[model samples]
Target: MNPIDDMDADPIDVASHWCLQLADGRLQGDALARFQTWLDEDPRHRAAFDTVARTWQAFDASPAAPSLMAMREEALSHYARRQSRRWRRPAGMRRPMLAAVAACLLLAVAGWGWIQAQPDVYRTGLGERQLVRLDDGSQLSLDADTQVEVRYNHDRRQLVLRQGRARFQVMRDPLRPFSVSAGDRTVVATGTEFSVELLAAQVHVVLYEGSVDVLPRDAATSPPPSASPPSPSTVHRAREMRLVPGQELVAGIDAADARIREVDAPRTRGWESGQLSFNDEPLGQAIERMNRYAGSHVLATGDVPSASLRISGTFTAGDNEAFVEGITGVFPVTVREEGPRYVFVQRPGTSTPEEKMTTQ
Candidate 1:
């Protein structure tokens, strides 16, 4: 019987069947095609198969595996003997049944092992980038000066962006949604691509593909406060927002301010390629991002209204000199060398940069 035809069969059982066939080098040609079709038909199929395959590989290295195998054989033999007397089944049919039983036993052991596993932490230093391939086939691209903690179990896959930024290309697991928590907000996804940045006073979420729900982390899990009724602003701050591709959502870390706007999603990922692309971004925020890659930090000082100055351009990640020149050339801003740091101040006898630039 074709395995795929058994639609009512347990997914784990089908996965175990494929694992066994592949392990003994039985899947080839048409059998390989069928396996691929089944895998692509549902995300859960691939997830189950990965779990079973990992368990099969781990079995050889386990110290108690020999004793466990002995116990399984002893039990199978006793069952086979009882079955032979009752139904007198053919030996050929019994062997397949015995193998399926063994696979389920192995899966049970794998589940216990997964529950005992510890969370993994990944970090990147200043001006460094790291690409991490998770066990479940998801990929994480960490930007400079970033730290993330990944915890995966049978129930869910969770990550915390401790600092900085990272992009996630999540693998689809219908039973387990992927979630990344940054500050008080959490971005939840299922088989999607998105980036989450923990800024100084805001959490920025940019969705590149699929959709994500940005919500307060405690809203769903924590019990409602009983001491006093929350103000309207407090309730509004805790409200969830859904983001689609090409949309950017910025939520305040210390304030109840949140806003969403259309953005060039691809431009937001320029940092992954050692490029910083900004589209009318605040000068201070852009400078903060540049400092992540700079040996000498850039500081906005003096009577310069840096907050009101917006910059638009693309610059190399670590090119501090070029960034300084770019701003000085366009805006009425002067760069003063102060040891290793560069201080930006308003040029003498010049109008505000934004007003001057707008007039031109």
Candidate 2:
């Protein structure tokens, strides 16, 4: 069989080979044209190339490039010595050596393939985030302190969001359905780009592209209540809430009706760029978001009207001090230390407590 057959069978492996060739800076004329043809032949080719390019860009931007380059050089030199000795080995040994080399190359280019081939749990620590590309071409961007359990089968793809938020870009698969379960709520889609956030007692689903059906697990089994409600049967039916692009569905704990609203999808994912954007968001809710990135906690205190006031701005994630300063600067509020937690209340002369010490 031709060596190129292996590459033709797996586009990501081929993309990795081409990426290495491009790194050598020797691709020209006919070679570049052939590469372009390969990319244009299939959509998977372009996706693989984009993934490889992003990996290269990340490596270039990282501070550990020097040590990583040194490791690469050492690995290459060792491989060269092995190649020189391989020809002298027995015929049986030669096949194993070639297979080992192929496996190593595949492992290098598509590490995520091996990871997603089996059931796996991916998680991120406090203030940390992760980008994961699954074997089916779906990508998951997990936010800080998030945990997800992934299980893929021939029939369907399933993910359980144990905690925190995640942005999912799912590839279309007609035969298999993709679903994410957060608490009792499950958001199902064939192919879509969306985000699911699990808060203390709420599950927020934001759709950036395509459509998804957000339903409760016990929707079908439960009957509609007899009380004189505004929407009689909407709450009992789970498939009622279908989200399109730029639409968000907020499902509160034990709440019959979910609130659906329009939002700026890009701004909703500002955490991906290490920033947070709020557009007239509640002060309490804003503080809770900041707390997700900060080790220290901040809470709203007293019957302060400012706690429910609308706040709008962008701030760097994990900068608790700057967030407090911004709050005091704009809203009529003051920050005070209450043991381990920071309390936000209405400014002095009100019923709320006076500021003991300012953050900044």
Candidate 3:
């Protein structure tokens, strides 16, 4: 066999080879250390290894696993007999060849099964809050009109948020990182509780407990400017930011106006329990959010000045009437029914001098 073939293979292919070796349950001492060192050598190596692990884990979850394992045992015995008869083959080469054969046996049995074992897609209707429990004991709480696709492999747990908001309570797995992709950013964690919301071009992240790293989608693929890349240990060298508990990171998909700031973590998740809390949020923005859970459309009209005013309060979701009444009590505006929509307009004769000047 040409040694150059193995050297030229991608890390993912190499990682799969290593996975097969470990599955044979024969490696000890030096072999194990070398595997660990290879994992630590590069982030791509770990990612590749995780992909192989995911495929294996998916097989374990399949109903055909038991029968497949039985076949694998039979194949191992048959291969052992064949190898015993080849006396001219070097002893050192025999074991390595046997390992490769064992992996092929598994692939033959479950190649299609592995692809079918990908995670399920979940969605919630408007104004609905649904909770989902994953196979790995992790919990996902999806907010109104939300969509998420979940996939767990032996090496990593991943979720893709297509839109809306969701809270994640991830179980701890040191070897396999948990990541959620939204817009142009990926939020990675080991074990933590957090919430993510997609608004316009922004991916809003709130870390309630533990820690998470917000990274650009291409952070793993793009190498640095220099000829040599940074070591895997220097994870911070990538264009990423680590967020601690009680912090918020808003990443812009356009790569502009991204910001990290502190917030009341409890208030951020209040929507999960039917409580909507806003802290000095703009009236227009607040109304748009509340409309997510509302049946009757609330429209801003007449005086645009009041739309930019800051408002703060806690109200129940779907209670648009109460919210409008509350706003009118404090602000110089009134809510009136116009067909199917409730329009907020400036109160008659209440326009400020600045507003009048601007209008003229």
Candidate 4:
């Protein structure tokens, strides 16, 4: 019998019935509307539903879930046999008794699930990208050579970016703030679109929409006594910095300070579409971004003074030849082919025979 049919049924029973119906994807159309009406009929209805949902989530996440489920099925089977052999209880009594048994079993299973929920790890190889849809409806877009680990529980949603870059479309859950930790910094948001990149010794955060707080991962801890007092800029870097849309924050890994500036946020995610946009970005950094997609790396020797020179433009990712041509065309740089690798060097004052012939 449907638990909802009994108007006198316990709210938990009704809620559990609704949860099962929803989990099986059977509630739709008028039935879904009826469920909504029931939820709104009493404040207790929503609370009961949330409780049952959380309990089920916990139970499912338990490491011993399969064994517990098997035990539950066996107990239910034994109960059914005993009921068949004895005098039948009234329908009202039967429903409540069954609910009590199920509730007890769920509570027992939940104890194990609540202790730990396994984290999910995601990674992308060189020249590959990945899109992930989390259980809470948040989305993650990972760039090539990226890795992240995700862990979700009733109290919080947490992720750690071990390397590379990723864009996040976070779901709003005030009860559970979403946080991503990259290096020494952590980005916290409720509902926002942003990207975090771990580039060499720097961590870059770009906020495209909504707001976020970038703070030190261990803000509560004090530095050791042997350490010198921080500079004013370092003090500012240690405090939480709130970011609005279209702003970017760059924090150095080993340094004590950070920089925040306005940026074209949308253009920063151009790598998602195979287009890399650089706006007065250092040539060394641009080469690093390009190398994520290139099979043969493009190297700039330390002697190449132009390596620190800034370049600006959009270029196709992985097209190393085109990037080389573009760099040589504008900056005082020239390319030398070394097997599969391309090396950039400072251009000579006089044109070489090959350069003169090509120009002619």
For residues 91-145, write the lDDT of model 1, one tens digit per residue.
4336788877566546544543453475689999889999999989999999999
Q: Rank the candidates by lDDT, best first.
A: 1, 4, 3, 2
Candidate 2 Cα RMSD after full superposition onto the native fold (Å): 13.5
lDDT (10s digit) by residue, model 3, range 272-291: 99888776656766676687
Candidate 4 residues 1-360, lDDT tens each? 455876866676677666556544566778777887998899999888776656555555672687756654554454444444433543233556655656654653343244245578999988899999998999999998899999987678889999999999999998888899999888888899999999877899999988888778875122212333222222244466777788788888866677778888778999999888887666777778888888565555434544356768888878877888887876666777877678877677833222210110
TM-score of each: 0.61, 0.58, 0.59, 0.61
Q: Please rank every candidate by TM-score, starting with the best.
A: 1, 4, 3, 2
**Candidate 4 minimal-lDDT segment of 10 residues:** 351-360
lDDT of 1 at 180: 94
Residue pair clashes in candidate 1 = none
Q: CA lDDT of 44 in candidate 3?
A: 86
lDDT of every model, 2 decimals: 0.74, 0.69, 0.69, 0.73
- Please tell me which model should have the higher TM-score, number 2 or number 3: 3
In candidate 2, what are the lDDT values of residues 1-360, reduced to their tens digit? 211345434554566556545544444577776777887888998897676555544444562688645644444344434334543543233446544543444344444343336567999987899999997999999998899988987678888899989999999996888888887788888899999988777788889998887768555223222333222113343344677788788887666668777788888999998887776666666666777787565455445554356677788888878887777776567767877677776776755423222221
How many clashes in candidate 3? 2
